[model samples]
Target: MQEFEEFIQEKMNPTNIFIKICTFLLLCSTLAYGQAGYGATTDSVYGSSLAILSSPTTLPLSPAPAPSPDYEYVNLTGLLTVAGPFSTFLKYLETTKLIETLQAQANDTDEGITLFVPKNNAFSNLKKVSLSNLTSDQLKQLCLFHVLPHYYSLSDFKNISGSGPINTLAGGSYTLNFTDDSGTVHIGSGWTKTVVSSSVHDKDPVAIYEVNQVLLPEAIFGTDIPPPAPTPAPMVAPDIAPVADGPEVADGGKGKGKGKGVAANSSTPSSSYRITGRNAWMWAVIVPLFVGLIVVL
Candidate 1:
């Protein structure tokens, strides 16, 4: 009996040691997982429920939430208060009486909008060509070409790289391209200009992408300018060959027939030599004499 008790203790000791080792391993694993920011639940000896533990550290999330679009109902006049070169464009919009549409809102419902405004210099460049002289419909067409149907933020632009076209209210679309490593935006063929400021006045329910220049659709400017009237196809006078007045028909018949023969003979030129006709001589000789006179006179 004494030997058996000693054997039991020996077995119990190993089992307890194994249990302790397992507990130590489990604790280490929990700590490691917690450090890695994993959530864990542990059961306490006290008759309470499991305790949940969350990692203390958290990763910073990317892509902040988009701004609320609420104030876009304001017209072009209101936009002028917002800084940057857009103010000048707003003035032109007002002068052009485009503010009316921008300010108009539904009777009670609020809606969001996107306005792609060209810079003042863009208008100046356009004005130099006297495009403002174009009819109202044409001017509106020009303005609409700059606008997109949807509100787009700068973050949206980065993904829009490569050859992709977005339809505008302009009755056409503009192609998008990435011009810089930092994702500065450019629109239209060749990606000519950079987006100087993006996501301005976004809370106004309008997304405005302020680029360095006006975005003109390829169609608007791509057409070949008509070749200037092909230089009026030089007026060339037709070259009329002089007639030799071929030998008059001679009738060998004599007496009464002789009269007819003489008449035909009289109509014939006295010689076979070339007679410089009025217009013909002017081109043949007068042109040379005129050159000589130019030097002499």
Candidate 2:
């Protein structure tokens, strides 16, 4: 019996040690959650700010910017302001129907986004083509050739010399050649262009570079916007008429000719839009850690 008791004690010793270590880790995690950094939660006890995990992380996010003001550009003010000199050139994005894709709130991702902007002169050449000659997919391809999968900023490539390939979101890549002349930056590869000025916004979130000359993929010219789709034809119901049981005059002697018909219109209900960007702090980090503790250690 004494040997059995000794064996039981030996087995329980390791269990006690593990519990203490887990307790320590739990305390540290709680402290980390209470931190007041970029993605931290803010309870009054922790003396931090509260926020919804979905919204962008801005420092001192007081008086949140007006939701999508009524300008020509609905949601791309952030992208426009950072791109500096390329500000006017991105107008083609609107004309080419590409702006709708980028400004859409649904496409937030970690892929590095690179935009190769064309100069105004490029558009002048495109205007010569008539719209009737273009296909829907061709216009989409022309605009897509400008976008790259990953984000590359002017500062990231300012010092590098020699030629390298930059891939585009359209499944094509363009070669890049960089030259620095006494502090001025020049970029040339397929098309002639120079970066007049550039700056970074919100840290690594945006890298805007302004350039002279146009960056064409040799595909945009001669292309035109596609025609709008034709409207669908309205549906017609089948005609059904009641048969005359007797002559126009009934056996009762009253003269009858036709019956009155009623027509009713059936319409579908419209859906309402909901307000997003609510500031509710989600406790996503703590829940996972607590669940794992009860499982494999």
Best candidate per lDDT, number? 1
How many backbone clashes can be found in candidate 1? 2
lDDT of each: 0.58, 0.51
By TM-score, the best candidate is 1
Q: Can you write out model 1's per-residue Cα lDDT over 1-297, one digit (the tens) per residue? A: 999999889878977889989999999999898866532233232223322234355677899899875442444455555645777667656666766665552112255446767677766764324564667776666666665555556666666666356556554444434443476665543323546465456643466666667654445555443333346577899997554333345443333432334445666544654565776867888888889999998
Residue 114 displacement (Å), model 2:
3.1
Candidate 2, residue 192: CA error in Å? 2.9
Residue clash pairs of candidate 2: 42-48, 112-150, 112-151, 113-150, 113-151
Give RMSD (Å) of candidate 1 vs. truth. Answer: 23.5
Q: List TM-scores for all candidates, in order.
A: 0.42, 0.36
lDDT by residue (tens digit), candidate 2, 214-295: 5444354423534445899999998987644432221334334444112111121213332334422233656677889978
Clashes of each: 2, 5
